[model samples]
Target chain A: MGMCPEHYIDYMHDYLDGDITREHEQELKKHMQSCVSCQKHMHELSDTVAFVKSATHIMAPPHFEANVMGRLPKRKNVLGIQKWLRRHPIIVAAAVFFLLMGATLMASYPNDNQFSVTTQPNLVVDGQTVIVPKGEVVKGDVVVKNGNLIIEGEVDGNVTVINGSYMASTAVVSGQIEEINETFDWLWYKIKKLANDAMALFE
Target chain B: MDALVNKRIKQVLKGDQNAYADIVNLYQHKLYQICYRMLGNKQEAEDIAQEAFIRAYINLHSYDQKRKFSTWIYRIATNLCIDRIRKKKPDYYLDAEVAGTDGLDMYSQIAADEQLPEEAVEQMELQDRIQYEISRLPDKYRSVIVLKYIEELSLQEISEILDMPLGTVKTRIHRGREALRKQLNNL
Candidate 1:
């Protein structure tokens, strides 16, 4: 039985699997009789295969699947949204900021156009000025300078007028409507007051 | 097709998060086995296996779709185990003398008994010894041998997983197993 090293090596796996052809098997058997080194190598290969094949499989732990599953993101619907947002963090952040701003503005001023303020008498107020209609009250010492103040009823607060003007009705001025129509501080204050009230509602 | 798996994985990378679970289910068991063999403890193996999967999931975009997904995951798990083994200096605590005498005796007794063929039993015992010897191998050889023999990956697969040329993978497997055989013969 004559065998080349290459053929024997090629057949080594088949020999171990017990699937060698008859002629090659005879050839290998005869070669192994005198080829001590090749025989030892063959034995080693067979032993290695046997050893590996005999390895006891340690089954993964009880929560093996669960542990891996837990590592996976929870199967919530929002994870998809989160993943999408994570992929585009910049865009999502911008969108969320604008969305929150719009919601805040809408909540802060439910109605867009009109604002009203009540006045008190006897104190010299600094800035209370708006375009008041024909019949409105000026109860305190009020001054109107800059803004258009529509003073329809009695002014209970001390009105100090500045740059803006106030169209006030003929009513009682206890102190003075001091400053008006100067900087539109009256309208700014009313808008600011509405914002503060909205914030208070949130709390 | 493997492309289908890669496509699913691409979906996972592209913000289809649920698609990740499918990839996990496909490879977790095989990864667990590798971790178990390398780490040799159930709890640690489980943790390492899960972490390996999660890491792979997070870095899935970096994986080349042309390669087998199994090979990719195996590489990650093996590298992690090797890193842990190195960081912990497994050799110091992994002294053969520290292994339980009872377990070794019981295994030897089984080998010496009549339940199986003498050759088969000796092979089994040698296999256990080989596994122990693997832990004693230097990191580079250790990884290649484990991936080739114990994990039963093809040479191409091992090379791909290791990101090495085929020649290097084959040489490492040969030398690693030879080292194990030498250690076993002495034992």
Candidate 2:
């Protein structure tokens, strides 16, 4: 019985690799003795391997070492803080998160004893008195906490005075006048101010 | 030699910046040859080889001492070459022609008494044919063949460099050789 072409090719590789057993080797030799096609296939595979093996080794061009060395990245000092930060990314991220959190808290924190005041050209602050001068137009709202609001001019918007009194002389007040002396009103004002400051911080 | 290279690596880690030039000199030719054979373009090979060295230097601290330095460097170079091959469109014939012509001119000068001039010419032609055929193989097979025959690396080394199983590398080599044989037969 002769070996089939598939078996012949399989044995051919084993034979070339010296991996065939003695019995298989003898059987393959017997098949090869009569099979011209298997012999040709074997030679072609062997020649292919040999041709690749004999391919010339190409040397790098002149100054190749110099070129590579010049192109090499400069060694960075790992002891630097930037390197340390790179190695500990989680710590860096956590530090940044905490810093932002602290800033937001500071900006949003309510101060029970501090008050802010804004004055237009018509509204003036003189030592302890906030005065809206006569013959001047106040275009926006006027709010005063813990002090007296004196409007002697054209107040075109609302006037709110908290824990304080309001005095007007010929004032053209277009909006309502509010005087807040209750504790609930003070707490509400503080909450609104804190919210406004927080929004400004984000913007 | 590995011990010496390891010593240099340690020196580099210890702030000896110039010590890396020695490592570059040690493997430049081998790395360049592998890239040249794989890409079939001299300029690309040089550029890729230089990039490999730069990458290796940047990542030197991550090198595992258990493996050979040559294996680590070769792995970096081979990976870069494979990425470049995948990213770019195939320009097989253009590179083959340029490299083939250069190979013929270079080999003609060294093809003295060992073989007749006519046989040398035939050998050069065969070399060009093999290179062209190698460029046409699938990326996986081409990588194994170039590392195997051109670099003469052991199968185990190739497996390590490729991060592939030994059996898989063997199969690729077998398939690559078969493909080359079919091409040769066709010619």
Which numbered prediction scores highest in lDDT against the true structure? 2
lDDT of 2 by residue, A1-203 (tens): 23465776767766754567888888888988888877777789899889888888788898888887777665555445666797899999999986775566556434353454566765688765788887788888887766788888788877888767888767789988877777556555556667879999999
DockQ of each: 0.30, 0.59
Per-candidate TM-scores read: 0.52, 0.60
In candidate 2, how many Å is residue B85 off? 1.7
Give the alpha carbon lDDT tens digit for every residue of A1-203 in model 1: 13456677546545653557998888888988888877887787767656655676556666666666666754465755766787898999899986776566546432323333334342233344343333455443444333345455566545654444455556444544544332244445445657878999999
Candidate 2 chain B least-lDDT 10 residues: B106-115
Lowest lDDT 10-residue stretch of candidate 2 chain A: A108-117
Query: Candidate 1 at residue A67, lDDT?
Result: 63
Clashing pairs in 2: none
- What's model 2's lDDT at A156? 85
